[model samples]
Target: MNADQVLQTIKDEKISFIDFWFVDIFGELHNVGMPSYAIDKNSFVNGLEKLDASSIVGFKSVNNSDMILMPDPTSFKILPSDYDPGNRKNARIFCDLYDGSTDESSRYNRDSRGIAYKASKKLKEFGFTHTNWGPEIEFFVFDTINVYPSPYAATHSYGGSGYSIESKESPWAKGNVSTAIDIKEGYYPSQPKDTLEGFRKDVCDDLYNYFGIRIEAEHHEVATSGQCEINLEYDEMIQMADHVIGVKNLVKVKAKRKNKVATFMPKPIFGDNASAMHTHQSLWNGKSNVMYDKDDEQAQMSQTGRYYIGGILSHASALCAISNPTTNSYKRLVPGFEAPVNVCWGLGNRSAAIRVPMYNRNQEKSKRLEYRVPDPTANIYLLEAALLLAGLDGIKNKIDPGDPIEENVYKLSPEKKREYKIGSLPVSLKGALDSLSSDSKFLEDVFTKDFLDVYSELKYKEYVAFAQTPTAWEVSMYADA
Candidate 1:
């Protein structure tokens, strides 16, 4: 749809409010709404000039904070009636940030969406038309959530901070513990135990009906405590990112309407499976799958595919800075929760960082690489862009991604690991940031040096703050000492 068509639709559908949506550097969605009467064809071209970039994290300073939101007509969607229980109809469109301070008003250097656009264009320079990304988004739904240091804590003498979460599907639910799922056994349980089945269905319906984002599948994940995974159909990079943001917002809103809380945090609970956005990616050129090879019997993976995996493995440590951006994210990357801790690639091996699915090896289109390092906390645009750039670098240099590791990486002995040249990912957010500082040349194409520096600085502050703060577990372990 073009700008003219968007305007026509506004009048035809009687859209009362048009919301312009965009994301910050951290991938958090933000929007600005305007009355439909105020919209015109010029509004699409000139953009909504009301955003102050200074207030947004990792954006411009206050003195030069002016920004513009150029709405993408292709992303226009009429929201469901549940969005606003009134007579007014609401519609949303994704926007690209531009500099409103200068006369030219070029695209903002730090705009995550703009960076994604640049990344997609860069693929053509490497002889590939585009890339497809399918993210297996995982999150947790809890009956109730409470956090310490509440808004009224300043009036009291509270010295500690913590959080508590409850889920009816967990073994610790208040009533009907018999139906609660056991630890690490929540995969595909039937109706009595899988309480959120209907809720997931509702979310999927909203995604397709209202937002036009297709969900391939939805099911309970490998955690007993209300963990769920929703697989999105593969689409172009930018569109997929938009779908991700919309899906997350819809899930949270629907959960709240049902008197529940939803979180995409990687490690919301202890001693159980954690949420991860295991992404499946493939490069294509005019309907041809460039990652497939009929001659290769081992994995049926083309040389291009191997180089792409090589690039990801080479930059896996630094990529984690964007892929897993939170302090809590590192907790989920540990060995026990089926998360990828080692840097290697294998066919049908979940322990390796990259897995080549062997489900339909004969089908050329099914050939793709599944990156297991990222979680839902990541900025999808930035993460996908970084992954594409890294893979492109590998192709440019023809980097050889060594042999595949078929065995379980976690069970491998130290000697075996060394022999296989399997390296572990950064253990903490600080480590990932430090790695990015040195190994970020591959990302300089799309993510400018200034952008990377700003991102790293903000993330570093978060890591330091988390490091200095004492947790409940720490207090319990050493309070007597």
Candidate 2:
């Protein structure tokens, strides 16, 4: 909007505060509010103002503390009614962090978002203008969660008392028998079977009406109890990152009101489905979709598209260090259940890490590859941006990610697996960190020495904390001796 247009909208809509939002490396959001009196269309459209730097996550010290926030108008969205149901309505705008004085690219120094920005800029520079992304963000709802350091009951759960276990009033609670899939299972149960449908729809409706995040769809995931998936339309590189932060906040808030707790943690429970944010991506230029070929005999993917998959598959191990940054993320990627343990591309196959969606035959816009490795806990900015860069690198090199494994990769013989040249992801957090330590030149400009240093240090500390502790399994088997 122009200066007058924005200013008038503020007046006409009676929006009280302009909430400037930005995220840190860990997907934490920080906001600065500006009263309507202080903003004009021109000022708000370009950027509202600046903010302090050292206050956010992954910072080293205060000596070199400086940052600026320049708002992106396209991200304009109204805040929830609860945030401001009165005269002053709340709203959000994604921001670009800049150096306070020197224009020396303070953004380049910040860890995740900055790197993603650079990668997107590079994508544009290389004639790949449209890097669209659709992430199937999954989450779980719980009754309550409490943490304690004491050794006696370090791990515990107490959700049995809730109506979900017995009551048939809701969809989830309807067929929730502990033992068997309700002989009358509610996989896609109606009425009482789909208990959380109303709550899910409300969240989607609010996001669309308030923030303009259009929902593609939402449904009950396989976990049956608390697992759910809500999909939103994909946007450009950075905006999606910003939206990711917003999505988390909304989920937590809305769930809390319904007396439920939400967790994006990859593996929250044993023997239950874990949450994943599998992303589907494709590139386009103007009206032409670059990833699509109207006629193709092999896998029906364009040459550029195939190479892009190759780059991602080759770099998959290294990408996990950032894309699947959390320690718990490993618990979700293990070989078994439904997670993608094998690195390969398959046509319409879910077992492989990458798959071309079966639904996209003639649809021009839907042509894309779904990358299944990422979980809900990823740092969307850095992770998504890194995937783009790696794929672009593959495009540049014309990296041929040979032959799709159509058969069940899990059932493939050892020699057959090797013949196809597929590799497994790191088994632990330390392994992923080690992989990233050397192979990540793509992140050099943004993840400079200091950034990686701090990240590695923090992760290593976490590893040591877990490593030093004794597990119940160890005690059960060894303590008897």
| Residue pairs in clash, model 2 | 3-42, 170-192, 171-192, 171-193, 171-194, 171-195
Top candidate on lDDT is 1
Single out the weakest 10-residue window by summed lDDT for candidate 2. Answer: 159-168
> Whose TM-score is greatest here?
1
Candidate 2 on 65-97: residue-level lDDT in tens?
A: 655567666677778864553646876777776
lDDT of model 1, residue 42: 73
Instruction: Check candidate 1 and list the clashing pairs.
Output: none
Clashes of each: 0, 6
What TM value does model 1 have? 0.97
User: Runs in model 2 with CA error above 4 Å?
Assistant: 2-5, 38-52, 84-88, 102-108, 148-187, 445-449, 471-478
